[model samples]
Target: MSSLSTEHKLPEIIIPEDYNYLAFFISLNCNLKCHYCINLNDKNSARKDMAKHHMDGSDWAKAINRLNIGRDDLPVTLQGGEPTLHKDFYRIVNETDDSIKLDLLTNMAFDPEVFIRNVPVKKFTREAKYAAIRVSYHPGYNDIDELIKKTLRMADAGFYVGIYSVLVPENKEHIDDVMARCKGLGIDFRVKEYLGFDGEKWHGEYKYMDAISQHERKSCLCKTTELIAGPTGHVFRCHSDLYANRTPIGHILDPDFRIEQIFRPCDWYGFCNPCDIKVKTNRFQIFGHTSVEIKDIHELN
Candidate 1:
């Protein structure tokens, strides 16, 4: 992990009233090279930028601690190609303020013993619709038996954990079997709808029809309910902007930065990322929620 200069004062940033979710992309490098990864589905995806900039655990703590997350329903989600890939994974989790709950999305490739010893079970506990530590099961990169063993071990240790798999066309046949086995083992297994194109057709249900069309590009005002933080503490207005390495709206570590709820004009509406426009379940596990809100969807004159 790289150290940031500490000479400057940090800001006491407040969470926006309308903010619904926090996603921290701690690192984009993953152990498993899953072919269906939505993060790598586009030309603008930041696969090359992963190694460029990443903050030390202390810096992450200082910036994230400033956030006043007031709702029990909202949590600062630690995610990445694999968040645990960060060198200070344990320190980051331990250092974040306890008042703000945490959620993690990971692949079960890590040592459970290390995780059990470092992460307190209570830090991840919150009143929510789904598990706090979400484990993504990639059939080709991982085995069901091994993943089950890991999941069971964590659950036995009193952690809020669950297994989820993307329902790709090729994997649809195996999902039911996997779900049944998970149910038999007393695990909370879920099937996630695939979000990208499958060579034949696009998979997910989206709020905007042309927003994700690859060939079309348009201008619009886009607002997001998500507060997205990249590895180096840069905040972005949308997923497309983040992955493309476009100039960030602000940096969390900057003393002057604050969350703004108003919509901002965008020139790449039709080329929006699927993750932002896709219709999916929210923190409450309620369906019919999209990450962003787009208005004035029309071609630039």
Candidate 2:
């Protein structure tokens, strides 16, 4: 993570009009290691290795501030193994342009008092059906009692916070109970569908069935509408490429960098990440949207 040279100003990167999501993986190192973590969906051990080469806060702010995300509805999301784990997390949040709102996806492993003191509440404040700061509730790993206390403290301080947990089959009963308890305590808690395997079968709804089959690698042309940046400031075509540490589509710090909406050749179609191919909701809260569009699919001999 070298900072961009101060001698030259980087060109402004314009976000595509059709882009639905923009995320900066400030750090991929998490305090909690959930068994069903989606970042390891590719089953690659090197996924977390990039955490060491993460661009410092100033570099991240420089790269991010170059973006022209004209729409207020789509905020640049800061997420990772746990975004709060980044050493310069607060600086990155405070340095980003005021025109660009931010959303945080975290595990709530940090002290709320320090977070409230340093970060401005308005940076994450926005109008959305869900809270801007979304916390993941991992049963058995992150204690529910502590999470409840932190959520209450942040909420009382005027920050919109919400807790979410996946509906894994084994934890379904427990999650249901927790959801009820959170709602009763005035916490906005929601249950998300589990998107990985359970040894017996796959548990998610995907647009391309073979993408997550893990049977055989195929060739296809894929185009993505999401802007996913890795810790090293490399922009990837999709989440699969980002987690696998594959050759990036481009670097965010590149002076000539801009969004390319065309489909590119990909040989790892069968090994596509579930997040990219999953039939999920768009920013409008409308269903029936997939992150990447794949075409010209065939087996690679």
lDDT of 2 by residue, 172-210 (tens): 889989999998999999988799878889988999998
The per-residue C-alpha lDDT of model 1 at residue 212 equals: 81
In the range 1-301, model 1's lDDT, one tens digit per residue, is 3344545657577777677789998876688878898886435436466445688787887777888777778888998878898898888889988888899999976899999999999889998879999999998888888889999999999997999998888888899999998899889999898888778788889999788888877889888999999888888998888778775898878777888888898888777889999998887777888988889878886
Q: For residue 10, what is the lDDT in candidate 2? A: 84
Clashing pairs in 1: none
Q: Show where candidate 2 strays beyond 4 Å.
A: 3-7, 41-43
Best by TM-score: 2
Candidate 1 is scored at a TM of 0.94
Q: What local lDDT does model 2 show for residue 170?
A: 86
Off by over 4 Å in 1: 1-9, 41-46
lDDT of 2: 0.89
Best by lDDT: 2
Whole-structure CA lDDT of model 1: 0.84
